[model samples]
Target: MKKIEAYIRHEAFEPIRLELLELGFPSLTISEVKGSGRQKGITERYRGAELTNWLRPKVKLECVVASGDVQTVVDAILKHARTGSIGDGKVFVLPVEEAYRIRTGESGEETLQAHPGVAQAAS
Candidate 1:
């Protein structure tokens, strides 16, 4: 198993999410975050005062998938998250030692698949 963490623009969330779901990766986590990269930050005028935000707003998307599905999930994120510009964000794939479903006490890959009834209810 592997954990994929992607930092993406706020506007890119919906599309990337839909793409992931369409690709059968419906179970994932998201968080509102602020970060800085090559694009630096932004400067704007507020009340006629120059204000610079060192950390830009971002969306952090995380999901654990089977090792075999790593590349596919990464590709989907890239396809939907890219804006052809700096601050497009980053994606990191890491090794996952193990995973367990708290509700069923199921471990390994079985815990990664979305439950059929839950998937249906989500739709």
Candidate 2:
């Protein structure tokens, strides 16, 4: 198992989600986040004043999938999130030792398949 985490531009979240769904990856997590990368934030105006170094709003996406699905999930994110500009975001993949479904007390691959209509990683 693997966990894929991505920090992406706020506006790109919807497109990324849709693409992931189309790829049969429907179980995921999303959160509103604030950070800066090489762009190092940007300047904005507020109440007739210039605000510098303001954090940029981003969307953080997390998904745990079977090992074979990692590449497909990563590709979907990249395809939908790229905007040909700085602050586009980054993706990270990490090891997942185990997974379980709380509702049904299912473990491992069974837990993943526990969700209706959700595709499980091919073991």
The TM-score leader among the candidates is: 1
Candidate that scores best on lDDT? 1
RMSD of model 2 against the true structure: 4.1
Sum up the clashes in candidate 1: 0
> Over the stretch 1-123, how does candidate 2's per-residue lDDT look in tens digits?
899999998888888888777677778899999887786857889999998975788899999998988999899899989988888999999999989888778778665543455544421
Which sections of candidate 2 miss by over 4 Å? 114-123
Could you tell me which 10 consecutive residues in candidate 1 have the lowest summed lDDT?
Answer: 114-123
Each candidate structure's TM-score, on Cα atoms with residue i matched to residue i, is 0.92, 0.86
Model 1: residues with Cα > 4 Å off, grouped in runs: 117-123
Q: Write the per-residue lDDT of candidate 1 for residues 1-123, one digit (tens) a residue.
A: 999999999999998888777778898899999988898868999999999898999999999999999999999999989989999999999999999899989999999997666545555
Question: What's the C-alpha lDDT at position 104 in model 1?
Answer: 89
For model 2 the local lDDT of residue 37 reads 73
TM-score of 2: 0.86
